[model samples]
Target: MRTEEYAMHDHRRLGRELGLFDTDPLMGAGLPYWLPDGAVVRHVLEEYVRDAERAAGYRHVYSPVLGKRELYEISGHWAHYSEDMFPPMRLGGEEVVLRPSLCPHHALIYRSRSRSYRELPLRMAELGCMYRSEPSGVLGGLTRVRAIQLNDAHVFCTLEQAVGEARAALALIRRAYVDLGIRAARFRLSLPGEGGKYVADPELWSRATALLREALDGIAYEEAAGEAAFYGPKIDVQIADPAGRESTLSTVQIDFHQPERFGLGYIGADGARHRPVMVHRSVVGSVERAVAHLVEQHGGAFPVWLAPVQLLVLPVGEAQEEDAHDVVRRALALGLRAEVADPGQGTLGARVRAARLVPYVAVLGEREAGAGLAAVRLRDGRRPGAVPVEELLGRIGGVARARGAELWEAS
Candidate 1:
């Protein structure tokens, strides 16, 4: 057997080879079409994050991808961020634009009703699809795309709650990275400095930055000048790929300007209306980028729980075809993503080679079929002898349910 590595670790190439996703010239650049295999991985990740957010007291909501131009204007995106946003479209005498961020919409939700101090720290979450007018030259694979689905959330809380909320956001980021086996090389406290891009409020910026610092007291992070958004100071979670290239995958921002601009307020215990602070957080900044990162991080060999095709069943010959079908049925019944390879498609060795990237492979032969067993082959070069169909089901199901990063041992 020959073992080698590609000179260029491009996700575009890996995505094609794995049948994950693709882009078309006719469809336009930076717009990726998620193939079935790719969609499965995305679905798993989305569900995982959704459950995590729910447990963290975030109430999920669905918001439109387009909003009135004035919404962004009120949120300060129109004056400061219009260049990166798509040009506004006029419809029925009203100008609308594809939302570049979910912050404004979330602020609207918070202001839809009269909130009180008792309901402070209202966490709103959404897997929001957003669009940006990215330059064609910079568009590359899933990492940099014109359209993105962000794992985004915003918290409207009192000043006293902002610090705790920021710390909780950091904890969520750490837990997510740990679960996905991603290592953040460093954290960066991005502050506004000598830039017209930031809101001109020294006191707000100082207070916001200090709150972030207090929340991150024991955590290590470096200060980055002028890296913040126009509306806020943020903490960026930076990670490095195998090639030593680094990118920010997660962020927690403290926004003091948006609430004031939108007039977002809640009744305080002192019987007065006070502006609430907004905390913007994303566990995985972009689902597409996260997939690209994982593809490279694992060299396209995804863990069983996240693998597009967790198991592939191969029939040794025509006589075992029924057995292979049965295996697939059993696997599917247990919620395992499994399929049977065409017996006539290729030789057993060729078929096995074709499925090497899959996490698990089950070879069904005359002996195995008669005994109601399967010869299991693991991607890690483990060839476990024939095992009962029921046992194999339990093993695969257990690992998937547990979100285990490795295959279960066949004893």
Candidate 2:
């Protein structure tokens, strides 16, 4: 598609057209309310990431969006990141602020209990909420919203294990991108640059930078000074939009600062205290931006497993309503997301076209309904001949369960 026309497929427009999300003046800029469809997509994405984390031995945690002002002071966010953070709010006697990051809370979780060297790699994950004080001009759809739901995780491990953990995190990111249809435009070794609010620890910075390089050992990446997080160096996975504008969608960072500031320590094998290194990584950084990118990447035609409406059932006429609904029920019972479009809504052809982005469209007519079959039409315009309802549901269910990128499950 031409660039001008491709702009129409931008997530902002698709959000409105596809009932994904929207912004209201009364609600203010930089905040968008996700519509029902958008919420479904978000929920699915969160669940997928959570499951992935769990399978990788990461324990999930929940942290409040607001933290005591003292928390940020200790984490160094107040000193270096206050410009981008929302101002503190007074609650009774204590001052609290909307957290700009989840690292501080995760750090506290780690400190909550005494740790031993046996749990050296304590992986903690959360689909947490955070906010930014973005200017209106910089705020756009889900891409640049002030309210962010991040798929964030932190790995607290021994210095010897930090590089290996970082590499594992990067591998997980690559796997996620392949399934989500995201193409990384580049991999960046983000380092602190001149004039940046970087932690003034030269030795720590040098060591962390070297560790990240080891994590990205064989991967080709350009070293970009000044692009690193305030605390440490990172490997940033970059993706571009249809218009060729690029942004970071995933990251893996090695940090030696937070543990020191938070006084985090674990009992060593020799029965002495040792500071554990912290590694921060996000397979898909912000859920909002990730979905926005996916919207544009597939033009709202998400992979079967990620589609808000996996299957749309259309009845050829009122006489087929019962059969159409039956098909929907069977699909739903098989753990598929299915919906039925009444014959009264529109013509069969019109209904199918209306749901062109849906992964599967099952048309039930009197003839097919009598034979207990459905004529399946795929989003990419393939009409898989009529098959028994049970068989069709089973195939789609298998694909969704496998999180298959293609409409058909691989043999």
Candidate 3:
């Protein structure tokens, strides 16, 4: 697509132009409803995340959206995120609340198994939909929402292997982010404040926080006092957009207390009972928020792979409609996201130009469909011409599977 054709304001104009999702006052403003197009975009992101995670040895799992209040009381969620959680429901005298995170559910899953040391460093992931009770005013398009689906995971490992697993997760996150087009990064190693801002044992906090620092020995860091979870230290990745605005996009946290609280244990090498350390990470934060960042980062030109509609065949007129339809049908059959533009809408040049302005779009008509070729324009700066379908498919697949900040060029 031509660089000059893309609107620089597209990042903010997403809600107005794409209208992928919307929130209503009567339905409670902070929540968003994903339109068909938005769902397609989100699905693209999530599938990408799943493939990345699987490559990193993560096993996916499904957990409940709500848990008993007692569960949070045990995992420290109530003390830390109660304000962000939905009010508890009295279920036959027991309190239940919508979950704000996936750690507790993952811990529960661990407890359900009588794990051996061989299963040490067990990594479980979930792209499951979760909920919180964020205030209405905080909601902004896909950036903030009361309900969200997270790209979350938990790694349970022995104290000795904790750092190694953390480093692996860090590498995994970095790989994903880099492939997705992230460039400059801020690695914030979070710690406890001086006067006991955290909820765990003070000495433990000091020792654990320092341990994290040691793990970050070579990497540049900014210390964030009181920015950690109640039980441990965290490494947060804050991304810089083209406009220079920064936002926290990914996080990896280590918890020393929660596994013990739930008695999630396994037999050690010495045949002794041992509590595993838990590392909770949400590499993409929330799909809602991640999409917001992506919109801003590339200014809505979501690389060829992530584009909601991979290609838009612009037929010159009614005479070319059959060819365009054939192109669209073949693209769909091959599992590619492609569509056809309306010839009656405007001039052929105008239609082609409009399609190019979107993240990923192509003009496939008369000359090429008959020639069994595709006219391609990439989100990165490639222009039209004809190419074999298999060749184009392979390149597009590579782009879709890519993760990280370097995934796309800036607007």
Q: Which is the leading candidate under lDDT?
A: 2
TM-score of 2: 0.98
Clashing residue pairs for model 2: 193-226
Encode model 3's per-residue lDDT on 1-411: one tens digit a residue: 234333353344664476567766777766777778778878888988898888888999999998999999998878766777889998898989888888889999999978879998898999987787877676666766778889999999888877787778778778767666766478998776654435758666776676677667787889877677767778888886555656677888878778878998999878888888888888788898788777766666676667778767776678778877887787787777888889899997777667654544555566766776767665455664677655665555555554322323332
Q: RMSDs, each prediction?
A: 2.1, 1.3, 4.1
Q: Please state the error at residue 150 of candidate 1 in Å.
A: 0.5
Q: What overall lDDT, based on C-alpha atoms, would model 1 receive against the true structure? A: 0.90
Between candidates 1 and 3, the one scoring higher on lDDT is 1
When summed lDDT is taken over every stretch of 10 residues in candidate 2, the lowest stretch is 402-411
From the highest lDDT down, the ranking of the candidates is: 2, 1, 3
Residue-level lDDT of model 2, residues 1-411, one tens digit each, is 677777887999998999999888999998899999999999999898988899999999999999999999999999999999998899999999999999999999999999999997999999999999998899889999899999999999999999999999999999888777789999999999997599999999999999998889899999998898999898999999898899999999999999999999999999999999999999999999999999999889888888999999888988998889888888888888999997887777888889999998988888899999998899989888788888888888888887786675434
lDDT of 3: 0.75
Between candidates 2 and 3, which one is better according to lDDT? 2
Error of 3 at 258 (Å): 0.3
* Backbone atom clashes (below 3 Å) for every candidate: 0, 1, 17
Best candidate per TM-score, number? 2
Q: Rate the local accuracy (lDDT) of all candidates.
A: 0.90, 0.92, 0.75
Least accurate stretch of 10 residues (summed lDDT) in model 3?
Answer: 402-411
lDDT of 1 by residue, 34-126 (tens): 999999999999998999999999999999999999999888888989999999999999999999999999988899999999998899999
Pairs of residues clashing in candidate 1:
none
